[model samples]
Target: MTNSPTPDQPRVIATDAALAFLAEIREDHPDILFHQSGGCCDGSTPMCYPASEYRVGETDVKLGEIGGVPFYISGSQYAVWAHTQLIIDVVPGRGGMFSLDNGRERRFLTRSRLFDGGEACPLPLARG
Candidate 1:
């Protein structure tokens, strides 16, 4: 059950491969969140966790939903990346040790492109 982005252009989206992988992951853990982790040797990589397992922090910002799961990042990171659209893709590799994609042999990756002129900028802060 993928959720479409609202009237505001989405800040994040998933590739078909990523959506397929996310669907498989959803079978076991029905509720999850994709968090864009902060920097540190790929700590910036996105991590998937069961919704109940991880708590969203104060500065966490909900970028948007991809494949029905809400995607998030720190407000500071959002500030740095607000002009880009996050593209989630699936790749062959071990996922983050703490991310649900771990042990699956395929992991989620983030790619981005700067929004073209005329697209919306600066979405509401701290939206989750």
Candidate 2:
């Protein structure tokens, strides 16, 4: 998931710190993925879980990969976030209750930047 930046490319990315934290988590949980639910309880934060744990429904869309993990968002949320790139970073805090990062003292945070005028459109939304 380490693609060079070039116009609307690589819709999702993780910072060095984020990558390190992800690696740490991966050591314990080999296959994990992330989902940013638009629900109220989580405050729109990205939640990390084992890939087999959370069931991706038909309404969710795969945004892209970050830190070699697949990232997804509800289609409703995707409609609103489609124009921006999701920058996943690590912040000092407890992660979501059901997320893998919960007890790690550092959680995955999302930051975004809008796409440029000449960039290509995002990939086709996939059915979960």
Candidate 3:
């Protein structure tokens, strides 16, 4: 795994709030893995997957475990995220459903909903 960020940079601050959120997911799916990617914004959003079935892209990366859960960073995105940290939180959403937070100023990542004969989860937020 990459080194932790300097004191001035954003470091993965795993607070009780964040740990509680992770615990909820762990209880629901103990085998899930957490990962982050790069695209628009500060970087990309956190993505969860079934650990047993998770696939890594063809890139060199450092794998680290946080809160006893496996986490991965893509080789290409590592440098950009070196000074970034991720925190988890739940926010109120429409219909009383909660949206996930990555502790950044940006709310979440947005992606295309189109798929090939298969369903994909829509992003929690909309993009311009």
Best by lDDT: 1
Once model 2 is optimally superposed onto the true structure by TM-score, how far is the C-alpha of residue 46 displaced, in angstroms?
0.8
**Model 2 CA deviation exceeding 4 Å by range:** 1-8
Model with the higher TM-score, candidate 2 or 3: 2
Question: Candidate 3, clashing residue pairs?
Answer: none
Clashes of 2: 0
Residue 83 displacement (Å), model 3: 3.7
lDDT, residue 127, candidate 2: 64
Cα misplacement distance, residue 36 of candidate 2 (Å): 1.0
Per-residue lDDT over 14-109 for candidate 1, one digit per residue giving the tens place of the 0 to 100 score: 889999999999998999999997877774479999999999988889988998899999888888898888999988999998999999999999
> What total of clashing residue pairs does each candidate reach?
0, 0, 0
Model 3 regions lying over 4 Å from their true place: 1-13, 41-44, 58-60, 85-128
**Candidate number that wins on lDDT, 1 or 3:** 1
Q: Residue-wise lDDT of candidate 2 within 1-128, one digit each (tens)?
A: 33344644877889999999999999999899899857777644799999999898788888888778899998888888887888999899989889999988988888988876645375677864
Estimated TM-score for each candidate: 0.90, 0.88, 0.53
